[model samples]
Structure formats: C-alpha cells, structure tokens
Target chain A: MSIDDKNVILEIDGLQTYFYSSEGVAKAVDGASFSLSKGKVLGVVGESGCGKSVTAQSVMRLVPSPPGKIVGGRIMFDGKDLTKLSMAEMRHVRGDRISMIFQEPMTSLNPVFTIGDQLSEMFMLHRGMSRKDALDASVEMLARVQIPAPRARAREYPHQLSGGMRQRAMIAMALSCEPEILIADEPTTALDVTVQAQILDLIIKLKEDFGTAVEMITHDLGVIAETADSVVVMYAGRVVEQADTVELFENTLHPYTRGLLDSTPILGRRTAGKFEKLNEIKGMVPSLYSLPKGCKFQERCPKAMPICSEREPQLTEINDSHAVRCWLHIPH
Target chain B: MGPRERPQFTTMASYILRRVLQGLLVLLAVSFVCFCLFRYTGDPVLMLAGKYATQEEREMVRHAYGLDQPTHIQYIKFLGGALKGEFGKSYVSQVDALDTILERFPATFELALVAILISFAVGVGMGIVVSIWPKGCVSRILMSGSLLGISIPTFLTGILLVMLCSVYLEILPAFGRGDTVQLGPWRTGLLTLDGLKHIILPALTLSSYQLAVMMRLTRAGMREVMGEEYIKTAWAKGLSPAKVILKHALRNVLIPVVTIAGLSFGELIAFSIVTETIFQWPGMGNLLLTSIFETDQPIIVTYIMLTSCIILFINILVDLLYAVLNPKIRYN
Candidate 1:
C-alpha cells in the first residue's frame, strides 16, 4: 500500500522488539501493528513491561543493542521505513520529523543545562539555527507552552523548575521544531492528578495547534480517555485490541481492556444505589521472558475458555474500526 | 518557568568565602600534625654535628638552629617561616628549602599534567564507546582490560612497561627525564622531544591508576545515565547517537567521573613518589625521598605543607566545578 497517499504519518506492522539476556530472550513487543493518522493521538495503554515503551523506542531507533534489539519491524514514518534507515539517516528524521517526550519529567531533562540550552539544542542541531536565533526561538517556544517569564525560565536549570513546569518545558523542547509525529511516553505519569490534567490539556491543545500526530503511551486509562483519538490495548508486548477511543470505551471488547476500565474509579454515579468496590483484573501481568503459549493474559483473563489454552488468537476485525485478539470473539 | 529566581550573587560569594575559611582551617590542622610528627622523628642537632663532635659542639649546633627551644616555640617559628614561604634551609644542603622544592616542582608538574590529560582523554573516550555497546566484543575487551589495569599497582605497571618497552625493545628510556634538548626560545621547561620521550614511561605508569578509575567510573556512570529517560528523549528528538550520547548523556556521566578525578589529583601527587622513584625522574618525589634519608627536616616539612595546600586548593576548585557541571548545586 502507498502510505503516502493516506494521512497516516506512522505505521508499525508486525513489529517485534526483543531483549536477549544470558538467561533467555524477552519478547517485549511481539507482532504489534498499528497506524497513527495525521493530527491524531494514538494511545498505547498497557501495564508496566507490556512493551508500550519499547514500541516507542523501536520507532525512535533508541533501543540499546545486545540486551534490547528490534529484530523484526517495519516502522514507516513520513514516507520512509525507519528501521531500514542508517544511523545517520535516522538522525535526520529524529527531532526534525519525529520527537519524543518521556515519562519522568523530574529526570527527563539534562540537569546540567538550562531549559533554554536544552530547548535551543533542537533548533540548533536540526534546523541549523545560530546560537542567538535558537535562543530566541527557545524563549518563544517556552512562552507558547504558557511558561511565565519565558526568557528567565529558559535560563533556569531543570532542577530549578517544579515537576509540572519541567514537563511543560519538556513539551516545549519536543515541539520546538514542529515535528510531524510526537511520541509522548507517559509524559504526565510523574505528576500528580491536578498537574496530570493540566499536562494532558496542554499536550492536547499543542497537538491541535501544531497538527502533529501523537503516540501517547500510558498505563493510566483516564489519560487515554482524555487525550487519545484511537487506542491500542497491549498485554505482554502484544496488541490485544485496537479501536477508536469512543468505540473502545463504549463497547470494551478485549478482557484486558474491560479489566482496565472496571478498575478505574469514575467521577460520579453509584451502581445499584451503592458505591461498588473497585474491580481489579485477577493475577499479575505475565513475564515477557516466558509468556503463555496461547493468550498471554489467559491465566488472568476472567472469561478464559478451554480453547484459549489450545490456540493463540489473532487480532481479527470484529466491526468497523474495532479489532480484538480473543477466542471468545471467533465464530465456532 | 514562571517567576524565575536565579541564585543570588551575594550568596555565592559568601559560600565561596566560607569554603575558603574551612579549607584554611583544614590546612592549619594538617600542617600542625605534620610539624609535630616530624619534630620527634630525629634530632636535627645530632645529624648536623660531626660523628666525633664534643658535647659543646652539639649544644652550639642545637642553639644555632633553635633545636634547644620548646616544641611550642619551634612550632610557632616554623609557622612563621611557612607563612613567609621560607622553610629556613635544608638541614643537609643549607640551601633555601622552598626554592629547592619549587625547582623540582616544574618537572613533577609536567609529568602529572600529561598523565592526567592522557587519563581523561583515553578514559572518557573508552567509557563512551564501552557504554554505547556495553556487551559488544570491543566494549567487553575494554572492560576486561580496564579491570586488569585497576588490579595492578602503579609501581608494578611501571616496571612491566619499562621491561617491555625500554629493557626489551629499547624504544624508549626506562628512567630519568631525558638529556636536555631545547624546543624554542620560550621553553615551558618541558617543550622538548627528549623531555616528551622521557616522560612517556613515568606518565603512563602514573596514569594507569587514574585511567582505570576514570574509565570504570565513567562506564558505570554512562551505563546508568545512558539508560535515563532524558537520553531516550534525546534520541526520540531525532538526535544523532553522537549528539544524544555526547551532548546529553555525557554531561550527566561526567559528574561522578569529575568528582573521582578531582579527588584523585592529590592521590596522583602522592603516588608520584613511587612513580618518580621507579623512573629516577628529577621531580619533587625524588627530592622528597633523598631528603628523608639525609635527615633534611626543612625540606620534608616544606614538601608536606606544600602538598597539603595543593590538596586544599583542589577541593575548592572541585566545589566550584560542581556548581558549573550540575546547576542543581547551589553553594549555600
């Protein structure tokens, strides 16, 4: 398919990211497939170690060698297969065409540099802006992110700023060159609820303004609900379900997605005239090193059937804009 | 970002002053201890007197050199002389002790400077390369080599190098700072081809410890730092590996490496005692060894005091460097 003909900016098909250690290989991301359209946000929702972060790193080509390797994948971004690009070529695509924000705002910034220095680095490195021009642009970007005393804030180091402020600065740095794709790996996870909302709002607003496609990786379902246009539910490095956000939330299909939705506490309305105890998905997430033969979540799946252990399910389209990997959904 | 507050200049000045005062106190304590210890080590009068001297002759020598004075009075006199940069005169040579130490200092300085420069360059370079491909064949080999470097003592390494390079091959001199060969009208006292050749073995021997220390610290620090969220963010920003690792990851790793290096500077000076003796280089280390055997009380005392002062100065420099390297550090 000619990807350029469509609005899809990023497309990952049959992506497999693995970690090879002395003991064994960990299939961190196995056969994951998804596409992000222009100006849309694709939320990759998963528990820790589910390979959402690895998927993001794979796209960025940032995975460390030996221990972590992208053995198989086709990561198409801006009319090029990123996995096939040379290190030098890949560099051109990074920061300029695709930029990423990280989970821990507290530590994501280089502590030794002023926020201004870090922000200006992007403009200077990719855009080839002069030092003064980059500095001016950095201040402008900080102001755009709603930072007060922009010029002064730019001069302050990352440690000097509050967590929320640092995340805002991080966003400013990420969006400095107006990248076509922005990969935010739990950008607000380190912030509190209030700050989380603010960060989420800021990201959404900035995405709207810049028209940048976003791959938002988060464990928090609430964050996905707030910012994601489409959702890819992952478990044990595999995509369990993929759907439009509203449809996925309204008609939660995959057992893992249902478990995630059930566990989150809603703002209002009591069920059966009483506040119900929060639901939790039974059992822990499976280890990536030795995932189960059939469904990775079979042991923890509340609706597991005999057939689940017998055969692994493939992600099959169930309806328009909705797909799920489950034996229950298959017609006998 | 909001209402930025820079660290006030007065606070920085006061902090520097406090550190200087503390350093002075430390120096005073160190000097006092060394003075008291050396006073009881041997009798200067006996060494000054001839083997068949009469009681009157010994007494006269004692009175002349203030050896007959109380310990407190002698200490006060010593302190007064030290303050004026005069350690009176060497007990054996009867020449100015300060001038004697200063003359040999240039040779030692040249050797030490070259050793440290080589150590930093090689160590940091190896560290960055090793960190990038920690488990690769080259990195693993380097890691093991660094381990071996750390395990061997400086003297042993010196001897081995001398045997292999000088004794076995005769490619380079095994000992001495080489015969005089002037480079230019303006000489650094070390800007000579012979000087360079003479310094190689001693400098290499001296740097082995520093190289091992810096390489290990840098590798460990780089490993930890390279895995950080900021590094990944930098890569995602589409920065080249060189840019991401060198520009972003390097600064964070340098904190620990620089700390170890700064602290090791004094150790290097102390270690030169052995390195210089092995090579027979005309440096302070040799002067110190000869003075000890000759019962030159003034030279010994002056060298100890000078070393203490250098250490204190380094500590202050390190503190200032910390403020520069890590903006999180405020002097107050």
Candidate 2:
C-alpha cells in the first residue's frame, strides 16, 4: 500500500476540478487521488463524463478557467505542488518533464504544421535548440517511432499520414524529450481497431525503451488489462476503485467496477450457437450538475444497500493492493 | 519519390488549370449579364444628343456609336472588343473605358490593401485578447463595441468618422486622396504623407466592419482551437502559453480566417463605393457611381468585368492559401 516517494514521479491528491456554466456547477473531477509510479503504466478507466480526462487535465494544470477550474488539489511532482506553480513555472515542467497525448491523434497534431515542424517545437522551446538542430532531432524521433522514411514523413503534414502513422507521430513527439511522465488520455480511442492495437503496442514499446511513466486513460477495460500495471476506476468524477490490474480484475470489489467488468463482452462467449447479451450497467452516469447526496452509482448498483442511498462511501483500502468505495466492503 | 513527386505536381497543375477555366466561364456569364443590362437601360443616343437636336441628328449619333445594330450583333461586337482589350470610349469623356478604369484601379487597390491590413492586425489581436480572457472587462467592452461595427452602415461610419475626426478635431483631411503621386500608369496616394493622412478616416471606416468580422472569427476560432487536443498536448509539452496559442492554436484558427479574410478583401475592393463617395477618395467606386448615373455603358461594363476578375483571382489565391495553411486540403 505504501509507495516510496522516490518511485512515484507524480502523485495527485484530493484533486477537485469543477466546471461552472449558466446552468450550474458540474463537478467534473471530484477529489480524485492516484499516483503514477516512475516507468510504469497506471490506467485510469471510466465512461464519458466520469472525470478521468479532467483529472489528467488538472494534473497538467491545463484546465480551462472560468468554465472549468481546479478548485483544490495537490499535484505533487518533482517536489513541487503543480497547482501552486506559477504559469511560468508550469511551462518548465510541461513537455520537458511531463507530456500528454490525447484520444484524438487526428486533431492532436496541428494541421498547418509539418510533422517535423511540430515535433521540433518541443526541442526548440524547451532545450533552446536551433530550428535546424531541432528538425534533425525530430527526424530521429520519427525514425525511433518506426515511421518509414522519417526524413520524408517529417516534411509532410498530419493529413498526409494515416491514422496509425499520426498516432506514431504523436508518440514520437511526446517521447521526443524523454519526459518523466507521459499522459495518454484514451490515446487510441479515435483509431481503427487494427491501428489501435498497433498504436497501443507502439506506446508500450516506447515506454520500455525510454523508461517513462504513463497515465493510460481509457474507457476500454481490455486496454487496461493489457497495458496497465495498476488501474483506477472512476464514476461520476469520483475514484470508486483502485488496485493492481490483475487484483482488480480478479477481485472486483466496488459494485460499479463489478458492473463495468460484467458489461465487457468476452471474446467467443456464445451459448449453443446463440450470442448472449452483454450485461450492461442499468443506468447512465448521474448528471454532474445535479449529482445526488448519496453514492453516484447507487441508482445502478445491483446490490445497493440502504446505506448507499443515505451517504457516499469513501475509497477505502480493502487490502494491500486493492481499494474500493462501497458500503459492502466497509465493516459496519 | 520521383514518381510520386511527378504525379502530385501534375495534379496541382491540372487543378489550377481547371480553376482558371471555371473562372473564365464565370467571367463570360458576368459579361453577358452586364451587356444585356446596359443595353436595355436607355437610349445612349438620346443622352448624347441635345433636346433641340433633330431626329436625323439622333439617328446619326446612334449610327456613329453602332447603337442602331441588332442586339446579337451588338453583343458579338462587344464581346469581340472586350476580348481584344478594347471596351471602346466613354460617351461623356471620350476616353478609352478600359484605360480609365485601369487608371482608377490602383487607388482602390491601395485603399483596400491598407484597410484590410489594418483590420487583419487589429482584429486578430483583439480576438486573441478576448478569447484568452473572455470574462475580462476589456474583453466584454471589445465584444460589445464590435457589435456596433457590424450594425452601423459603412457610409454612416464614414460620415461619423468625418464628423469626429474631420469636422470636430479638424486634425485629419476630410476628403479626397490627398496629393497622389503617379507611378507610371498607376496613381497612388500611398506614396505621399498627405495621402496617408487622408486615407486614415476612410480606411478606418472601410475596415470597421471587416475588423469586427475578423475579430469575431478569430475569437471563435481561437476558442475552438484552444479546446483541441493538440493545444493541450502543446501545453503539456511545457510550451509557454504564448507559443501554445500563437504557434499551435493560431495556425489552425488561421485556416478558416484566411478564407474569410480573402473573400472580405475582395469585397472591400468592390464595395468601397459608399466610403469613397463620403471621403471623395476618387477610387473605382467613385468612377463606377459616375458611370452609372451618366449611363456610360462602356465604363459600366468594363468596371463590372474588372471587379469580377479581381474577385476570381482572389478566390483562387484563397484556395492556394488553404492548401498552404492546411496540408490536408489538396485541389485534386
């Protein structure tokens, strides 16, 4: 349960990111806490609006202000609280120490810039590399990511490349600086399945080669199962469960986590030539603007208890390697 | 690489050729409409001859100008003359119509260029400021003020500017392109200090609406691009906010802005009539207005054709710019 402070490159504690609109304040990421160990993949899994992306944004301190603000959080990275860092100080950490790739590779790289130009920017901005030197480094990075004819592809724009190639370019850019942490926020969600596999493999391979820590965010449990060392399951802006990937999959504690696991259709699971219906969780994620006072997942929990309706359960450690937020796990 | 390069070059060359052909077709259609409209407006012979003149004198004038010919014959003659770059002489001035319009064109071109440049610089700058700080008091004022720019008539704006700057302050020149210097065939006010002073009010008046449009477009575009995943990636890469916005977000925003700006530039040149009249700028707009009132068929037809040609050329330039700003856009 205790992680060495030295081993953890980024530790996010009690992070609360809220969005204020004319309608109401939506708690996008409410008190989400997790740590990303150095040179390991920490998967954050949740459905849309569950705040996994918001949590990642909060860590980067890239949340849009006014509409969205980080009300409170201690994003401890490199002996400094990121939330407390000045914009100027944050600039030093971003892309140089911590880099993030997004779900959309197509839109993530700038359309107007050549792949080399965009990749070279990281070098020029952070290392003060000259344009020519940065471009040379960009070609090397592209080649490192296995982009064929890297020099030629460097001259081309994002649109000239295929989806997988763009994602490779993104990975190449993100790893160009060999940052301490890389945040992959559902990085393969926008890609085709075959390309998705290739992109995921490329990310994993690059992580090994560079020894970079990764916060792999996705809604797909299969991706977490394959690539994550640990998993954080979020529901309605709250971290409902956290554990080692194998432990969480085997001993799913939170009812929401159980529901999520059940909903994922197993490959080749058919009964007597008839396809069995996938077990979907009974209800949609509670609206963030008007979340109930009780547990966010109470309405959808198959084994909802009376206590679940009265108060929300905190994420409590059930074992050395597992934590769950459910009245069922807590001893009365 | 050689084979690929050859095909791409051919595709681009063919694309340009196709666009130019389409432009020619549009010109032909426009010329036909102009010829028909001018022919039916009134009898040029009546206008040419005095009221006391005999019918024989009117007939002689009509014959002299070839106005007595059949409509089809006249149209063919007109087309043939236009193709030969000889649109005949203005009835009133007895000057070659094409030469007169061409002489006036530089004045209009100079004014439009100044106005568009001013609008582009200020508009895009304000847009960036407001988008970055949407809730700031300054941004709110700018947003509200831009509404006035959009709502007020161009002539009224010109008149108001004249009243405030010319009548009230009496600091700047009220009217006329002050002290234009002849540059070969082109007369340009841009080369002289007094001409530059005279241009301020009219250029400001002409630019107000376009500036408002560019501002709003840039603000919206920047806001949208700010939400893009790549921008987040840029920020996460430890780039300064300036670099993230100017380099990453602005480039993408400019793709659409360039399109609107190009079209607006064409419009500014064609539609500076009201501004020119108020300021007595002696641009194409002023020439066109006089020709229309005097029913100068040759000048009117030539002006229409020239304006259409300029618009077509600008549109082609805009398309080429699109390909430059966004690599995804290919004519083929």
Question: How well is each residue in B1-332 modelled by candidate 2, as lDDT tens digits?
Answer: 56677887787778889999999999999989988876877766777786778999999988987889999999999888888988888988989999998888988999999999989999999999999989899999999999999999998898899899989999999898898888787788888999899899999999999999999999999988888877777777887778888888998888888899899899999999988898898889999999889888889888888899999999999988887677666523
Pairs that collide in candidate 2 are A94-B237, A94-B238, A95-B236, A95-B237, A95-B238
Worst 10 contiguous positions by lDDT, candidate 1 chain B: B180-189
Candidate 1 lDDT, tens digit per residue, A12-92?
A: 999999999887999999999988899989999989999999999899888887578888979988678889999989888
Residue B225, model 1: lDDT of 87
Q: What is the Å distance of residue A93 in model 2 from its true position? A: 1.1
**By summed lDDT, which 10 consecutive residues of candidate 1 chain A come out lowest?**
A1-10
Instruction: For model 2 chain A, give the 10-residue run with minimal summed lDDT.
Output: A267-276
Error of 1 at B88 (Å): 2.4
lDDT, candidate 2, A65-84, per-residue tens = 76899898789998999999
In model 2, the runs with Cα more than 4 Å from the true position are A271-275, A292-295, B54-59
Per-residue lDDT for B51 in model 1? 76
TM-score computed on alpha carbons, candidate 1 = 0.91
lDDT of each: 0.86, 0.89
CA lDDT of A195 in candidate 1? 91
